[model samples]
Target: MAIGPTIGTGLFIGAGQALAVGGPASLLLSYIILSILTLAMTTSMAEVSTHLPSQHGTLVTNGYMYMSKSFAFASAYLRWYTLALFVPYEITSAMVNLGLWKPGSTIAIRLAIITTIVVGCNFLPERLFKSSERLFTAIKIGTMATLFVLSLALGLGGVDAQPPWGFKYWKHPGAMNEYLVRGVWGQVLAFLQCLFDGSIAFAFAPELIVHHAEMPASLMPASVGEAAILSASIPGIVKSDVAQTAFPYILSSLAMGVMAPFNDTRLTNNGTGSGSSPYLIGLRDAKLQIVPTIAMVAILLSAVASGRSFLYLSSRTLCAMSELGHAPSAFSTRNRGNVPYLAVVASALFSSLAFVSVKIPSTIMNTYLLRLVTSACFISSLVSCATYIRFNRRLRAKGMAKRYSSSLQPFATYFGMVISTLLLLGSGLWVAPNGNLTGSRAIRLIVSYVNIGVFSLLFLVHLFKDFVSVAEVDKQMDLGGRSYGNRAGPREPRTQKMHPHRGGVYAIPEASGASDLRVRQTMFTEP
Candidate 1:
């Protein structure tokens, strides 16, 4: 269930685009690299989160607690809009799955209906929402399992009397495809493009797992011994979760490589629903009936389920920001059902953007949104690694015991930081260098790198505000000290003690001090 959003339309529908650009070899390689990166990132995060869980998700609270307020502000808002944008991204994908790829009145109506279902689910009572989520998660897992079995059956010639065509497409069309140009340079470009496109399937996955761990329903350790036991099991949990999520993808990629060649125009076609799917293509080619339709229905449900889960995540993220004083308090308000109704409403507003597909094809719109979401994901991953480094240092300084510690440690975090930076910087390089800056290419370039600009703007704005606040605090302290000295002849120096808690750091005055020193410390401290 924690992996619900990770396995979605991105794998089922968006992989078509990746397969189109990179061919089989690139698709397999890209996902493998991304999976390793994600595993490292998640293990590091789990180590930190298990030590001191937060009511608000670790993605929102960890930056402020372990790093700086300004970084927290920028990353939180960046994550907010990124998750918000995902609502429309999934909805658009669902529309495409429903044979409504081109923008029109029918597509618009379907969009509205699906959007309503996705957003409406979030407003349900907490128990009901959880039940629905579990149900959908089951469906997603089942669909994946079924597809994998089908892929194996089809590949081994176990379906509909068709001859075994093991790796036939891979051998003929070759392992990799050339993109924009021909030969080695083009293959390199195709691999890079696959890395970018394939990222969507695993975007924000670490954050999702951390959030799931912090949920009330999750089992929490009841004592120090229990905590130690939980900590010892974390690495196993991380590895198992990663394998469960990644193996299906790798198998599916291999299956697709055998099922349909990269050059098949149907894979890139605009409006054929499951017809564009390699699995369906293979099944239909084998003269298998009824199964493709069933698979199409499953894909459609998976998309809608993914959209609903993303809407839930986006709304909760907004609510967390409000709780942390980064957004309006009204956004944190909840109804009797314990739903953050205001935040849900605010986040749901972005789903209207799905209608933009009415003017543009859903395929193009999905690509644009995928670029933006993946860019945000890269930045967030980079920040998480940086935060973990600070957290690790603070724990060492305080000589504190960790509830969970990964063996891959500092190396993993460092690797994550380096890879994330490279990915973010190279995101737009897929646009190609033809000496002609076409309008479509220009738009793609902007969409690819726009999140970096937005993140910088947010960070600077918060940094300036923090600077002003500190200056004012210093000014007030100066005047107050002078006034007190004149009135009392001399003032006693206060002895302040630092106390670290699970929530954050606080400065407490010693009992012998003249006055209480109640300061809010945002930097990392031992818990």
Candidate 2:
């Protein structure tokens, strides 16, 4: 459930570019920081979600409880919009990938089929949805594992009589590739780029984990699921020829028309086609036609699965927002199957924005939306960190820090916030390479920071309606006693409700009437 959509095209395709630009050492370090951030964010969120459980709210709901409503609304709005748009983005990519095989299929017909499949999957009963997601995600992971084994076999002198190349690439490329500037600053810029790419790969894991935090019957705790998913990303990169093939090899392959550079013209190419991917290039060089064909088919399924997950994510986020009065009430409507049909439809409609790219060129469309999406991801991370900071302070305020303590409390939250802020601000570097904001550069700047502007406007609206001062926000830190929309607050322990799939009966322990906190503690707390 957690890893399904999290490691999408970014980890599958964009990782090659990261490995090419930042090298193996830089890639490892960037992912290390991201992994730590993932841990800190997930652990803190687990505490907060359990502390202030809400059926419809995600991390965004926790944000509202701990911080200002405006901040929560901004985060939710941006996140919801991003996820909605991403659905079409994924489906469109799937359609285009299909184009590689079905050259005669019209984009319109393919888009309709893709959209129908995505929405229809969500309309399944809750139990079926969960099972289906698990199966597809298992397939995706299995496919990736197969790729890893193949990469190792080839690197270890399998097929084509290639000499065994063990860690030679790292030594030659020298582990860190400079970018933009020179010396220390260039390394800093490269590291930041790696972090940004990593964040894109790790975009919505935190939001989804917040949902699992309250599900006692889940196979694994959300925090554990997050750690597993984040750990998988490292291997996804390192195992690829993107990291294994070495920089000199990549350059030489390009020279021989066997591969393209990281900044190849194919970079502008979108969709699931591996035209720009170094992984496919490496396979082609190895002359493994059968495996590449199988991988392509698997990647198509992977894209559709990601689209399905994003549909779930977007609708749920909208439902959460609607619960908080941030979206229309119609969005909160649900069917007998426990699916939010209205929210699903609304999100799908918004996802049609991907068709706009079909009309206008792919390069411009990707360039424009990618910046906005990347910036939103950074802002969302920063907001999550801030919300975690406030959540910890609230726990301490109520003297429940020991009761619901986070492993990296206080310091981790602060550190994550600082790093998130820097990434959000410096992400605009991709916008204006020469620092001259004109033409596309100017558009990129606006697109990158447009979320900030929208957030500001939303914050101003919040001020006009329910103005909250800094001191007031501080005073309202403790959510254990407050009320929101008829739901019980954190102080009043509510019974854990079973999902519709559970036949509306809560799963009991060996002894009934046992405390829910004990179950959560057993599931989440470090042994």
User: Which prediction has the highest TM-score against the true structure?
Assistant: 1
In candidate 2, the residue pairs with backbone N, CA or C atoms under 3 Å apart (3 or more residues apart, or in different chains) clash, namely none
On residues 1-527, what C-alpha lDDT tens digit does candidate 1 reach at each position? 46775467888767777787789899899888888898889888888777765557666878877876778889899898899899898888877667632335587788889988998888899789989888888888898788878878877756757878877777888899887779999999888877887788889877776666544312333333454465455556657777777777777777777777888877766322112667766766878778877887888888888888888888989997887677999999998999999999999999988888788767667667888899999999998998898898888988987776788887888899988998899898756644222246778789889999999999999889867765654454444454333555554333232322224322243566422212254333221
Looking at model 2, which ten-residue stretch has the lowest summed lDDT?
A: 498-507
Query: Global lDDT of each model?
Result: 0.76, 0.58
RMSD of each: 6.0, 10.3
Task: State the lDDT at 415 in candidate 2.
Answer: 77
Off by over 4 Å in 1: 100-105, 214-228, 270-275, 433-439, 473-527
Instruction: Give every collision pair in model 1.
Output: none
